[model samples]
Target: MTAPEKPRSPLARLFMGADHTLDRLLAYWFATCAFYMASLAVLVAEILAGTTPPQAGLILIGAGMAGVTSFYLLVRFSQRLGLEYWQLALYQAVWAMGCIIAAYAITGPIRGASMSLMLVVMVFCTFALRPRQAVALAATAVVCIGVTMWCMARLDPAQYPPAVELMNFILIALGMTGVTALSGAMNRLRARLKDQKAELQKALERIQTLATIDELTALANRRHAHAVLSAEEERIDGAPGPVCVALLDLDHFKLVNDRYGHACGDAVLRAFADAARPEVRNRDLFARWGGEEFLLMLPDTRLEDAHRVVARMKERVASVEVDGVPPALRITFSAGVVQRKAGEPLSDAITRADQAMYTAKSTGRDRVIAA
Candidate 1:
């Protein structure tokens, strides 16, 4: 899309970028902001109810909100640095974990509920991180939870019982493990689907080549030539310049096949195409019309220019040296060039070119004749 046309809406403007990558990063960043706000609300309730120390609670909440703002700015900066979404996302995930640990340390009996928050973090990671990354984060969470619970219980036995903390750790570990496994399975499935898509695209390209090209000469085939001719004919009325059609035939193809072998004849045919291909312009098409004949469609060309093109190709093909062909066997072609007129049918133009080619053959073995 053009630059001006991209994302002018107020909602899209808030993200500050029209790029799809930046949009996704901002999406996650916005989600992070919402999560932090909701978490602060819960912590505030605890502070009001006397379950958490108000002074410590306010400090933690302020720091958490500040961190959310900091991450948003960093995420925007990462867009300019060309960093990937996952890099910042992984870092934000770690920061969230830190906030959870801080909140757990300052709360009373409700400290056990931090395991649920940790579970939410693990599940959120599966959407962004790869399998290995998700597993690493899960492992880190396990260690942090264990250490925090051990310290809290030793400091206050009545508040955080050792048996209760142990059960919470086990449940947290099991939940994170399950989410990581699911992430791994999803990553594997995505890879398999990507491979299948590439293979299918290659197969379609091969099929298109076979449909439009001659395998032997690597030139457009008879069917493709017809299509191009029809299009040129249809555009003749308003075409910027004249369109020319030419038919060419090998001078002594059958004699070469009879004397040397079909192999040498095939070699000569391929050599002629290699010699003639360079003479063709971007607006022209060279096609194998039949067994020993070829057709050329030249757009924005006059009869004389088209004839000169074929004449140059004839000289090149005459000097070509094929691997199996004898030095005495010089390959050449006789062609008929004609400029198509307005309102003329494609078939009639081709018939005229074919007749001119036969006339060239009748007058001499190798020459270009324009009609």
Candidate 2:
């Protein structure tokens, strides 16, 4: 064993929840804040280039407003209204591309420097969008760049020379394609990792199931039975009535294995389990304790009622005939029933039940004895 989980207070929801509004905003902020930092760095670059950083005070404020407002709109409307990831990525990309282009137009002679912001935005979209959607966003950036350069060339031919604008267009095209290739590679790696994670989770569940279940009878194994008893012991006083335990043993099981061979013996045990399963209630637990024996635990059930349950099991099992075994073969079980004593370890109760089971065996096999 492990200890039970501690109860959590109501206020823990603020930070504990992953889907709660405040927690989601805070989680999103970690990624969103990086854009804010990048925008500040862009302002610094403009100042270093000896160009007037237009709206320098407003840059940080604008970055904050854009990041937060987009998230708010995405969560409250776009996401809530059930838009897809590609739609959300495209939604953010459109407005973001507009911001980057506007920044480039304002920077005058050092307009080429703003291409880095375009790279950052597209790469960020790569994580949230499909390959086709990312390509669409990149293509949109390419079109915006071409139009901005062509118009700037016409309006201010001195500041934006035709030769320089043509060269910038070539460089921007290459950068966008490089971003497309990067997104394709990332999507492949992420898909591979997701598949491996799913396989690992399935393997873990299979192992856990094997550990608790008996392979032969498909019943809870002794380890799981012990664990259940320990759990019930923790709340013995809180229960409505005493907890009853019954231990059952097949009479002369060794003779069946010896005379009919192990194959037939295995069949007999499986048949007995099938017969006994339906006799136990949903709230009660019946498990294969070990070789030639089974255990039952009934919480909040009296010893008399528990005895009746086992007697019922005994009656059902008496008529069971295993397939491929001798047709004359009859399966039967001897049982011992005991109610747990106050504050006593359940292990002790199981021992008493075992003693009573042996008493039933000695008296006449296929009978029930209460202890």
Candidate 3:
């Protein structure tokens, strides 16, 4: 009996579950909630120590709770409300800016802790917003902080020294703008790389399809057919049933080309493929072996069963008509079918089928010979 598999790591499962955009947004919301809780604890401690005014602490707590509640509602109903990621980012940015302004008013412009938080918000915007939007947000933040500092220094000189206020404003504005510019450049570089990667993937896929598929008949090409035969031969080793390989050649194909030109010959080939494809079973493999020749591999089928399938295909081929050809003109194919013997190589089976096909051609123009 097989042993029971070990469970996946909890951390791995968590990350896998968080792969969606909504899940990541929820994660960010939870992190922000924790940060607010910690900040509230610190504010309460400062109030108890008489370092911060009770009224100021109360205001900060109220604002923090309001931000938390807004984020919670947004997270819970974002999908129902059809809120896009960019819209959510814009709302967060606006809320953050408002919170910073309120904190600056209570804590003093030059030495407010909220000034540092504003820098964090600016950096975050660089990642969430487009380059132009990020730059606009940075500029708006700088102007707002500058205006707030100027007003504070003029209306309350004791609390906000003009020299200190000016220095803080310059430092914070420069920092926010620098980060925004760098992040925008990085985002553009990343987008270019992503497009290049996608184009490279498409190129590789086209190359693979060209290599394996016949351009004219849309069937598996000679190389792909041989690989399939080899794989089937290996797979059926010591198995319960027979594997049949049939080689089919359009009888007197040159007569069509000589009579109607190569263009009509191509049409006949394509029409034969269209007629024959419906006769092939899903489990069987069919491919264009070469010019006017095709190959079929039928797993778990006997030589006689393979003969019947090819006979049906021949009937279908005869009924197929090409443009510019007379109604009296009929198309037919001679096929050779051989069941692979135990431990026999695929090459030997294919050679025997080819010889049988030649025999069928020599004996009668359109017939199936089993070897």
* Candidate number with greatest TM-score: 1
lDDT of 2 by residue, 85-110 (tens): 56656666776677678767767877
**Candidate closer to the true structure by lDDT (higher is better), 1 or 3:** 1
Flag regions of model 2 displaced more than 4 Å: 1-22, 29-70, 77-79, 84-86, 237-241, 281-283
Query: Residue 194 of model 3: what lDDT?
Result: 90
Candidate 3: tens digits of C-alpha lDDT, residues 1-371:
98764555678455333235466777777777786687678667767876667898788889889988887778667877898776777788777787677667665423467678877777667657889888888888788889888998999888888898898888888788788878789889889999999999999999999999898898899998888877886688746478889999998899999989999899888999999999888888899999999999889888888888899998888987789788788888888999988788878888999999999999987898998
Tens-digit lDDT string for candidate 1 (244-268): 8999999989988998899888888
Q: Tell me how many clashing residue pairs each candidate has.
A: 0, 0, 0
lDDT of 2 at 182: 97
Worst 10 residues of 3 by lDDT: 12-21
Q: RMSD of each candidate?
A: 3.2, 4.4, 4.9
True-structure Cα RMSD, model 1: 3.2
Estimate the TM-score of every prediction. 0.85, 0.83, 0.75
Residue 117 of model 3 has an lDDT of 81
Q: For candidate 2, what is the TM-score?
A: 0.83
